[model samples]
Target: MTDYTSMANGGLPRISPYQAGKPIEEVQRELGLSEVIKLASNENPFGMSKKAVAKCAEALNSSHIYPDSNGYYLKQKLFEKFGYDPKTITLGDGSNELINLIFQTFINNKVNVVIPAYSFVVYPMEATVADAQVKTIPLKDWVIDLDAVYDAIDSNTRMVVLANPANPTGTAVNINKLKEFVKKVPHETLVVIDEAYNEYQKEEDFDDTAKWIAECPNLIVSRTFSKAYGLAGLRIGYMVSNEEIASLVNRLRAPFNVNAIALTAAIEALDDTDHLKMVVAENAKERDRYVKYCEDHNLYMIPSQANFVSIDFKRDAFPIYDALLHRGVIVRPLKGYKLDTILRISIGTHVENTKLFKALDEILKSLK
Candidate 1:
């Protein structure tokens, strides 16, 4: 038989597949439970806008036709809502696809990539597949150390990745400091800010970094409807860069990469600011509950701007995770990220959170 593993790219064989959060049905089937609450994936617990859902349902009739190859109307909606130039927008299945496109476009063995530790796993995964040396910088005080990241960049560094309101840790970098850091990076090096959870941030802390693309042509901002817009199931997202870079990525992007239903849902979702406001507001309200629970229990919860909070249990947390599973409550374990003592829990609805707290109380008491 042929040695298929040897035939693969240098880094492809070494990469571990991404582990998504456990689903409700999977837990129900395995545990023989009738009810399950999932607080693992950082999804909008409130769910998608009714208007977007209706639009998607209507769009199903036209699914046989291909999606707009250019994502024209969605780009127009983005331009109207946020003033993102349509010429500079590249739609993808999700921001995940855009991140991969960026790595495929710019990374190679001769170049390197710089990212803070505990970044969205895709950054390093894509860079590795492109055979680039990944320079992982340690976070300072649970936040990205911009100075350290900047210092790590060299002439061969092709890209620098930052995830505002970072995942797993649920910490965000100072926006002004991030801008200054971007300005300091060399023009030849691309700076990618993955704003996957941008909408969950407080208004005072939010900065639309897409506005900086004209000034910093090498800057690329990727965002998703999967979180605040509650369109994760549809898998729609887009990136903003200079027209030249966008055109380059577009050349390589598969036609109709974003499906018809997703395009329609995103357009409607973007216009439904009322629904967006409700989702973000509820996320903020529930996120505070997690903070208080951590404080009352003496577990340190990382201050988060995203829809999730990572609690440091200060001991191996796998047992707690397994216990929660048995109780029909699913949260994420960070062992894959080498964070054995921390569990990242997505802020769910009030009822769901209450169930988690009750289950957790029982589990913690049993330990005593």
Candidate 2:
């Protein structure tokens, strides 16, 4: 037999593929259960706006033709809504793809990428794929240590990944501290802030990094339609950077990276501000409910600004996660994030959230 592994990229063998939360069908199929609820992937349970769906339907007529390679109309819509320069924005299949492009564009074996330990799994995976030596700074408590991340920088550091309202942990650094860190970072190194859950943040005066793009040439802020906009299936996302860096990132992006239907839906999604607000509001209420459950049950929850809450079980959570699966519900296990005792639960609809607590209560009681 051919040695296919030998022919693959050197990083392929070292990489563990990203583990997405299990889909509802997969749970039913494997467990032979009729009812299943998935609160695993941090998707908006409210779904996207009716207008976005209508726009998607309208766009189907043009599906035979290729989507605009440049994503012109969507870019214009983004500009009008947010006032970001079209030249400084670049669209992608998802922020995930744009992340890979950033790594491919600037990373190399000679340089290193700084990341917070137990943060997003993608940063380390991409850094390894780019063959860049990764320098991971462990989180302080559950939040990214901005100062330590600053300390990790050196002449060979080409990029740093910062997730605001960070995943898994769902905490964020103070804006003032983040600004100070930005000043300390060498202007030559790119600071990539992955804000996949930006909309869910309820903090007053949350940093709008898009406005920082011009002054901070090295800043790259990425946002997606997957969460608050309920476009996870569409996989549409984009980044904000100075024109030069955006140009470089664009060079690595494939033509027509976002499809026509996605672009149309994204454009319409922006116009449906009410729907976005409704989703964000619902998330806040549900996240609070999860927090209350944790408090009442003696579990510790990392105060979250994102769509999920990371609860420390204070013991191995694998059995709990496995048990929850059999009960016809799915939540994210954080073993891959090096937090084996924590489970990250995405804020779902009221029914889904209540079901989770019900199952968890029974599981915890049995364990006791």
Candidate 3:
């Protein structure tokens, strides 16, 4: 047999696959535990909205038909809800697909993309896939340093990718700072803000990119139904941008990229205000409770505006993660993000949070 690895692009060697949180079923089987709580992946602990569920069931009756290639109904509903022109919208299998499509639309080997150092890892990976250079700006005080990011931009910079309520840290930049950065960026460069956790933002000064995108033609805001909407399994996300840019992105997208059920579910999920409110409220309460627990336990944690928290155990987080897993609890270890002493935990239900705290308390006691 021939070795196929040699035929691959040289740049492919530089890419590291994204690591998602471990599944609860796998952990349960491995540990032989009947019950397990997964406080990982930043997933909404509350189940999906009833309206979305009903719509999905309705879609099942037409499961034999292909999804609307243009995602017409969902786009129309999104336009009505968000007030963006339908022509400016582009749907994706998920926000991840939207990230990849952005590179496909605008990137070339000669172009370079700028990203925050500790922001979403997908930005760098997508740039690498496009064979484009990546300039990573390190975060200052656990928040994106807009000044530093501005300094990194140059004539060759084609895109700047930022994740508000950034993952692994959950910090957000102020509206004034983000607006100034947007104003200073060159017109030729595309500014992409990944707002996957926008619904969870609690800060008063959080930048609303939707409002700014109206003035900045080069801006793109990516959002998903996975977080507060509780539709991760369906993999539906969309990008709002200038009509011209959206056209380019649409050209790069696969036909029927979103499934029939997902399109229907997402449209219904938008009308689920009660479910959205409940998730937002529960997440806020659990997040505060977790933060308090961290403080009381003397574990240093970053102040988060999202549903997840990153806590520094002042020791190797891997051992604690393994211990938690053995106890039927799953949390994300941040070793790959270069924070070996930290673990990221998503906000769960009150009962789940109690179990996590109990497991951690026991683990900490054993460690000492």
Query: Candidate 3 — which pairs collide?
Result: none
Note the residue pairs that clash in candidate 2: none
| lDDT tens per residue, model 3, 153-264 | 9999999999998997998888788988897798899999999998988768665587787788888999999988988999999999998999888988999999999899
Model number with the top lDDT: 1
lDDT of each: 0.91, 0.89, 0.89
Quantify how close model 2 is to the true structure by its C-alpha RMSD in Å. Answer: 1.1
**After superposing candidate 3, which stretches have Cα over 4 Å from the reference?**
none
The number of clashing residue pairs in each candidate reads 0, 0, 0
In the range 79-153, model 2's lDDT, one tens digit per residue, is 999999999999999889998899888987789999998878899898887778999998898889988899889
Clashes of 3: 0
- Backbone clash pairs in model 2 (N, Cα, C under 3 Å; residues 3+ apart or in different chains), count: 0
Give lDDT: candidate 3, residue 282.
89
Better of 1 and 2 by TM-score: 1
Q: Model 1 TM-score?
A: 0.99
